[model samples]
Target: MLGAVFVGINAWLPLDPLKFCISHTDCKLVILDAERAEKLEPIVDELYAEQKVIGMLVVNAQEGKGQWRRMEIFDKALQNSAAGSPPLEEESVLAEDEALIMFTSGTTGLPKGVLSTQRQFLTNVLNTQVGPRRAILRRGEDLTPPPAGPQKGALIAVPLFHVTGLTSYSMLATMAGMKIVMMRKWIPAEAVKLIRSENVTLAGGVPAMVSDLLDSSLVGHPLEGLFFGGSPASELLASQAQVAFPTARLSQAYGLTETNSVAVGIAGEDYMMRPGSTGLACPVNDMVIVADDGRVASHGEIGEIYLRGPNVMKGYYRDPDATSQVMTTDGWLKTGDVGTMDEEGFLFVKDRIKDIIIRGGENIPSLLVENALYEDARVREAAAVGVPDRRLGELVAAVVSLKAQYGGKVTESSLIESVRKSLPPFAVPVMILIQEKPFELTPSGKIIKSQLRKLAREHWELRQKNIPKSARANL
Candidate 1:
């Protein structure tokens, strides 16, 4: 069995553990709860028959009698002479450097395999020192660290499987000797309760989580700090966060799985000064570089982001060619994000390169269109995509979910008109579809544009098929 400690901190704890084992053959599966043990019986029985059940380590079994009993069964099953080998000590497992395979949120596609070495894990942990610590030091205040206690630790309500939740809060908490208070899932009330009860100095989440907390009036007090990222937060949301939590420092960061949470963050005064910038690059890892073409775009000019430093993965597992596509020989990884850097080195993300819509010869940024739709009072959430257009090659299309309070106040034509007024005529969406429900999102709360594109294509095809005979003939 592989020597690895599985930090079980996700809502789908048992399923993740199963997937972790399946992805990495060497790692011994550690089930933290008896609830997990109960769920694993059928699967374990199947694996046992296949001679795959090697060893077991069940944590916190004493908390529940049934759980303890279930763990004992698992323990005994593995301990039987026929079961092969005994489980090794936790230190023995930690001694060797092993592959840690983590699953992506499967937001845009099937959760891709993310593999990092134990060295990479330590590198990423060390990388965290560059951002928050530097920010604190630059404050020119007293340099003493916060007193060790429950309140000093970050309050992490999100699950640990996610890169942001895991790195920003969980792993960071561990490094700081901070206690983690987790919920089965995010409940606004429960989050508030924990913040107050535990005196959680820091809380981390994406924009949607913050929006949910703000949507309800239950969060009535200021927090120590509110850290958000994984998706863009509009100025409206940023302002609301400030209004709601006057004393708390509000921040946002940008990073991807390949970087292992090499985050770029700007908060407090920086957030107020430049609401949309992703702040300066984290010093722990040199995460910022501009592509050759975009290098000369000037300050605030759009460019493809290139990342360099220890934070980048060695390469994609078992796909050297695919890995080579993103990694540079000189140690840079093309991030595929279109962004701009200010004279002061603040990074502002414009849109994703893949999501850019080329309508005729014009490059229409889908994020701008999405942001426009989001600004509409009637729109609750929106996603913009490029759909095939025989005449223009590609046309702008938007899918939007309306706010319940709007009561069908806005129509497709009205939304089109709004875009026309704000943007160039060619940039206006050629098609707009209203959705009663919000778009499906990843664990990080990023809208699944790929899914939305599929749905949009189907919707447009159906609409074309239903066109009147006269209209079709004219076309």
Candidate 2:
């Protein structure tokens, strides 16, 4: 309401992230509910002293004031300000003014603060509009219209702190005066209920949430526009969702915090035609696939995707050196994503540049391995990660969650054999960790591959530790 530049962070995050968020962004004031306030009590001194925080506004003073003695209660402050205050004077806010500090890349638990301006986010919204409906696909393509009602709502099952929930959904929805129904967490059953009850027409989330929603689907769906971000929607997931809810115009986007959420987008038939493509760039943005040799890539060649546009963020907040590493002098932001571009301009995302596993000088894309795993009937969710190997430097390893019915019965060896049939021997996961539960996901619904990699290493270390010294040498 005050139009103050704020940092949006996960309330469920540990104290280190909380401290980093405050200190890195130089956040002065904090607003928290009862639960978070209590957790923050331990770090109140650090926030106030080293971080130079003025104070905090607690939503539930009764519960929050136990150990965390904040200066003013939220409601009390609201009441006092309203009682005898003069007419509100709006500050001069420009499109260039800093609007938000969003953190990304916490796979290993250290997130970079991406700075964004209001105009940058607005362009991101526009990029979504242009990318999906560009002349390359078809101008004025008649996609499914949103359902009509007194209150047209969108369900945000992801946390508000995430870029998807904030800029991609809430900001756009709010600007259009659309009713926004929020969820504390992704509970597909409760989400189904909310969509039916609220008459939600614009409802979308991550692919995993969509899969869960299908499992818990009730009779009718009011959804007309279903959008996905954080990761690309798999062909199987997209096809299943289309079959389930034929009325909804399915859209998928690929972006990062540095891009303010949208670098490219695809929708309807355009998305379906390209099995795994993240889609084409908006006209306003210049997107190029730069090959390993530093030349602009030809069609169908795999390279690092580079983007430059109004939607691109100003820079990583207060980290000039870090910002310089990603942003080029001529202006293109070197996206660490490795992908191929077709003649039609659609981008096929393969894997991150850093995540490409090199075993004895042979480069293998993790996506190729993961895609092979997905081809198996038993696999539900799969992540192929590189695990440390003394001889090979890194070896292919996979952590997978089986489809509910296949759980406990499916052996790791069977899945490895399945992958081996599709991929080269070097690309096959040497070790597969089969689990019943889904991979622990980021707020944006991306699988935390780093966690699975760590899991594989720990398992290997434990097995080595358990083996007798003589037996280890003999083996």
Candidate 3:
């Protein structure tokens, strides 16, 4: 019911329509903190377009113990919304329409509003086979369900705006009539505490979030299920999580906003066998191939990923040209992922054609390099990109994060040594940058290579500026 804490500080633009839609629905009350009101008022003004009385239930989120501040903020926001605005008049808008409008992370520029319909939202939630479905099956055998009632509830820590957090994982939990808990903001330590205190049954996050939880003490707590999507989690991390949370089902999937949520996921036993695979196609979804010459790729051959399902979006809002670019006249949505299916129908993603790098006649898949470096205990995260190289046209470069045990030291020599020990020399990154922190990630936890490329270019330019003119001439 339009309940948020310090809304103004969380000024990410995409949440307005979603919040508005929720407030207009069964959730009418608006609750926010008084200290946050000054900031949130502008947001409420932007989101609440109707000319009606909206009430407030304000509390001191900064003061008081526990979640008192948040509780108060929620109380006040709901009260204000209900008391202030009368229910919005019915327009031509469909009753089953426009449930939420979230913006993309704006990788290229400003975020664009992605409107989701109620039917769309409901379909994503129900189709998403979340939590521990059919009990925790281990060793190809079914185990007993965890104690039912409140203990079986789920946790939602990721921000509500993201698709994984809102559309699939968390939304599925909410639709199941389970109690949802979240921190006023994401604090890994706080999330751990919630898991223990709330007896959380399932936790959903991206790879980065999963990595952070693994790095945190939270993994020690009792967890029944751990599912992540939006970005690929390394096989190393997935294995480690399974070992740590023996009782918890650990799995990952592949999907995009245009697909509504997850169109494919690895479940139970299959999750372990297909380490790098994106798992089998989800129920009611059809995944097929369209080759380079408009012919279907044979089984076991790589081709563009295409899909037909109810989960497929109703095309981008107000952008017909953009819609036609991805969707065929026959209704199959061409996902840009390059992949192949084995005889058994498990999909293995080779690489995105757009993301492949050609360097000195060598083809480098950034995902491969990133996966290798992630296997190292000292490496928290890594990303590979192509940079200008005079002799080779473009050279592969890597940015990496080191674990605390490594004393914050990331050296090119060490990484080079590691890669050389495992991969061929051509695939090894020539330039390794040890970042003090993890590379900046998208909301979905993907390493923003474009941002990394920009930073790398700047760093190279700065280094060049420091070199003496005579040194450049001599070189």
Candidate 4:
């Protein structure tokens, strides 16, 4: 509904129900499903008392009683309005007018509401269309005509709250007049079923989703393409996906919430050729890697990535200080991700600045170590973090989930040796913990490394206590 309203004069803010109350307190009205309405009943009463919320509009309620009886029924409100009056004249809205306030996924700390304009959202829609053309050019192949008969359908598995799902996929699909099949929740097997049943030609989300789809029983499904962004995907996963889905073009995109989703992307042969790269900048955006001193870094030199484009968000909502810190007066938004760009313009995201592990005074890119661990055929998922050490200041520790087929065959020492082959000795993990289940993933399908770091520390401490006092000294 917010997506539809964006086409008109009314500005809409999409809130994550879990984070909404804590992150925002100025909501004037809340339109929610019955389940959420019940959950927010007490909180809404407090807000109503405080005069923050004017009323609640509940939808999909079979029977209204108690608290719900006082609230307006959303369906009835629409029906009554339609019956009583003629449509009002549309209000004029400028392209510069604010359209949405999307909050960041506060993985690190408090979530900041990102303000975006009508122009920015539409600009992203236009830019996203260029992806297919870029893929064609990069592959040096003519566009493949759709198979005769039905319209091409796209399967949407990611939550609509995300920029990728809303603007990038859903909105883009709406503009294209394509058939959209939305999943209530992301279940890999269910997604595969939808793809086959709905004749879904395009499917994408995070790497984990793609990986699970490829590893599932329906690997031979007729998907035309698969693309993912949001987070870094291991090169090993890319290689496996390409082999598994020969008929589908595998692509990876690189962007952020502030950039409205994709600033760079690679597809087809280009993606397979460059293993860990996030690909070239999108035609609509300009990207530069800046050194700490503020000069543009030479190609292949790691630096902070800065992007400037129409698609960038207007600013942080009502937080000028935070906005000023990230966005330069000149219009460039400083992406806190550390990366390098090749001479050919391909960008390689190294790691998030906060995610880099410092061991014995040497900065180790956690992503590099994690990628090495993924190279092992038995490894299903991997995460690396720095744990405090009495002697080395910090030590590299890794937690990995293994393929069920190789359950007891792969050992901790073997996994450590695999990473040691590709990385320096210091960069090698001092401890490797195997997880029986997959690592807990964020809604966006990224591993919560902070939680893994805490788990790793606890496991290490427990192990030290079990060892003899003399042996603990060597450990």
Clashes of 1: 1
Q: Clash totals for all models, in order?
A: 1, 0, 26, 0
RMSD of each candidate?
12.6, 12.1, 13.1, 12.4
Question: Who is ahead in lDDT, 2 or 3?
Answer: 2
> Considering lDDT, where higher is better, how would the candidates rank from best to worst?
2, 4, 1, 3
lDDT of each: 0.64, 0.75, 0.62, 0.73
Off by over 4 Å in 2: 1-3, 60-67, 106-109, 131-149, 355-475
TM-score of 4: 0.71
**Model 2 score (lDDT):** 0.75
TM per prediction: 0.64, 0.73, 0.60, 0.71
Give the per-residue lDDT digits (tens) of candidate 3, residues 273-386: 677777777776788866888888899888998987777766655556667878898778888778988887777777655554445333356765676687787888777777
Q: Name the runs in model 4 displaced over 4 angstroms.
A: 1-25, 50-52, 62-70, 106-108, 142-148, 355-475
Global local distance difference test of model 4:
0.73
The lDDT leader among the candidates is: 2
Model 3 lDDT, residue 279, Cα: 76
Span of 10 residues, lowest total lDDT, candidate 4:
5-14
| Residues 177-282, model 2: lDDT tens digits | 6789999866778888898888788777766677676677542475777776665666777887777778787888888778888878888788777758788887
Clashing pairs in 4: none
